[model samples]
Target: MERKLFLKNGLAALGLAAIAPLANACKKDTSGSDTTDTSGTTTTGGNSSTTCTVSPTETEGPFPTKTPGSLVRSNIVGDRTGVAFTIKIYIKNKNSSCAALSGALVDIWHCDKDGYYSEYGGTSMQTVDYTSNHFLRGRQVTDSNGLVTFTSIFPGWYTSRATHIHVHVYNSSGTSLLVTQIAFPEGSSSAVTLVNTTGSSYGYTKGMSGYTYNASDNVFSDDTAALETAVVSGSLSGGYTLTHTINVSA
Candidate 1:
């Protein structure tokens, strides 16, 4: 009898642990009062550590999606070429005790594989003259489950900035809540090193010679790397998938 009880309890505990990360994705407090998700807290990078802290607010420039409201599609890969990357961003309401923030608007934009951004170029910032071109940028609204996904290409690095993706979140009323950027890990097995090192023939010609790392990046250098870093998976051949939960005070 004692052995059977132990097995049943262990299985139930495993089930709850699996749902912990999605549970802390966050929700909205319609009544204007503090609410908490009884689901659980976040599990960072497959670790046992759990917390529901608000995502750090960062700038959305050097470049931003010029007309994000008009680009409402899930797939933002418009003629760009490089390794495939899928972005899954979970928005949680810090004010609501880290419940999933349903129905929020999210805008994400990043540079192409060769260190180029569409819509604006040829000036001092971008010398490529892609002002008439638009790619690698799009917008999406969170589902009732507080999640938004985007189809894009694996981004390349540029001067002064490490590999990153810019994000802008808004309330249902279209009010801007936070502007931030997603950072990636740098290791032998990470895309940051592989995409630039062994991806030259694959069109990632920029290489990692003078690449900027997170430790030297201006925005994430202030110890915000841990808070903004995303958990990226997959490989050079099969493409990559990135998952990061952003908590907001909405």
Candidate 2:
């Protein structure tokens, strides 16, 4: 895990100066109010902190398409019902002083509330047909501020794995830059717990039962803290928001 640096003509250095305007534009809120967390920290979206450490790369798992264009779009929820969840990812180039990487393709996919993935079926635990169902899978291109958003349901857990979301970043030409995963904080938050237990009427079925936590997940055990996302906000009934910054070597 040696830190890699970017040269003057490297990908990170390209269009580095154009990100500020994009970031500012994305922050323009009609309500003129910042998003406040339970800790009273107000932030624009969810990237208020300044940590430039590169996110550890993780396996893309066995589900992602080997090539692009399988199912590319911004909103991936696709008729699946569960706790409403929105994920915001900020992409930065660590080699370029963590400059925001504009126009990068951010791809994300995860299992539905019942621990079944879309576009694939007949796995050991997943007997339902999903070859035509593309829920919980989508891609968004980074804006000028290096931000991409995905509208998805709260990911459900399957056997031998923790609650997590898979992310892949690529340049505009589809050159893969980073492959990693974002994990939820161990133990359900006040918002998540309610959805798991009493939100069954709202399409929640995981309920944190027989679930594997981050500490035990092999891919995340090396450094779970770094891979975990900030505590989620809002309730399952009203939808939730989770955000994290991803630093990658360009």
Candidate 3:
């Protein structure tokens, strides 16, 4: 099946639910070694040390620009405001024994503190107008280590979806490879809660209350544990840094 079609059907198979608190508490430990299973699927995190498997394919949401080449850069925060955040992603090719894939274009975009995307006008829930705004949207080419980093603010929560970021990876020649979203773990380990609740001017309007958890999001329900990013917080006054390794086919 086509990638987009597969993700659409996958979303349908996992029925959507009303926004609610997560039932399972997120674990604090986010470190683990990689090891390959008998099925050739590499698993990361938790107690297991296994070979890394291909990152799960996900839907390219409606908001992605029809032409994504124009938005290439290291910094994506155009003119937004919120707690400072740094995101680092490592790109590896599972088809080549989990080798690092350099020079790959990694595109990332997310909602602002008020849960509104850039370059698109405000939605019914978001009242601010941003028809020409382009915050939180940019692309970075992976370095020799297959690493791409972005400096921005921690994303805010919306109605049905959990706190997340959308990512799309393309080869040097611009062939789309992977389309996926990174989810923040729920509960005390949640970077979303730490930044929003304690700070007086962090700019996260919703905080954690009334927000959908990773366990409740249809797109992540299938494997919330595997997809959750490892988050490290400095101080509410400072900001947070998130890191995740993305494995994909060459």
Q: How far out, in Å, is residue 135 in model 2?
A: 1.4
Clashes (candidate 2): 0
Residue 47, model 2: lDDT of 28
Of 1 and 2, the candidate ahead on TM-score is: 1
For residues 163-249, what per-residue lDDT tens digits would candidate 3 score against the true structure? 778889999998989888887644443455565565447666455565655555557667544644544444455566677788888
- lDDT of each model, Cα atoms only? 0.71, 0.64, 0.66
- By lDDT, the better pick of 2 and 3 is 3
Q: Give residue 164's lDDT in candidate 2 (0 to 100).
A: 73
lDDT of 1 by residue, 87-186 (tens): 9999989898888899999999998887778887766556677788779898999998789999998998666566889899999999998888888766
The true-versus-predicted C-alpha distance at residue 42 of model 1, in Å, is 23
Superposed on all Cα atoms, the candidates' RMSDs to the truth, in angstroms, are: 17.4, 13.3, 8.2
Taking all chains together, each candidate's TM-score versus the true structure is 0.80, 0.76, 0.78
Report the CA-based lDDT of candidate 3 relative to the real structure. 0.66
- Best-matching candidate per TM-score: 1
**Model 2 lDDT per residue over 1-250, tens place:** 0112222122341111211112112111121123446763323322222677777777776567444466678788888888778888889988889999998988888887776777776543345677777778888888989999888887766655656788898888888898888766543234434566667887765565544455555565564444444446666547778788888877
Question: Highest lDDT among the candidates is held by which one?
Answer: 1
